[model samples]
Target: MDSGIICNNALITLIAIQNPVDRKAIERIKEMKNWQKKEFGQEIITLLRSL
Candidate 1:
């Protein structure tokens, strides 16, 4: 239950930081890949580091 709340809040915060359309796209991609919030965040960091 706690983890679910955290994931939900993290999604909301991520959406707030990015454009609304981009946020939905990202969320969908993450869901398709079956990634938890922490893994999704790590993937983002790795991608950013390569830029």
Candidate 2:
């Protein structure tokens, strides 16, 4: 599950379902963060984008 390749896809979905927000805005932020690093933090961003 943890191959050093952070999976932002799942985290984003969980958070989005829990808290709704503007899609476009969140996607922008997620992309920016993804460029920075795919660490655990980035996973959360990915989840948001998925939603």
Candidate 3:
């Protein structure tokens, strides 16, 4: 399986936990390089928005 897909699946699981989106989560996303952001940004944004 693609590593990006694997990572995204893990992210989905993490988001499933009841905790609120924290500064650390936002910072981690911000720390991602442009290419990484391109790979995962939209899914992250969509998931967080759904919360």
For lDDT, the strongest prediction is 3
Worst 10 residues of 2 by lDDT: 31-40
lDDT of each: 0.49, 0.47, 0.55
- Candidate 3 wrong stretches, greater than 4 Å: 1-30
List clashing residue pairs in candidate 3.
none
Q: For residues 1-51, could you state the per-residue lDDT of candidate 2 as single tens digits?
A: 763334355654554555424444445444335543334344555655686
Per-model TM-score versus the true fold: 0.28, 0.25, 0.40
Model 1 misplaced stretches (Cα beyond 4 Å) = 1-36
Which lDDT value does model 2 have at 6? 45
Residue 50's C-alpha lDDT in candidate 2?
A: 80
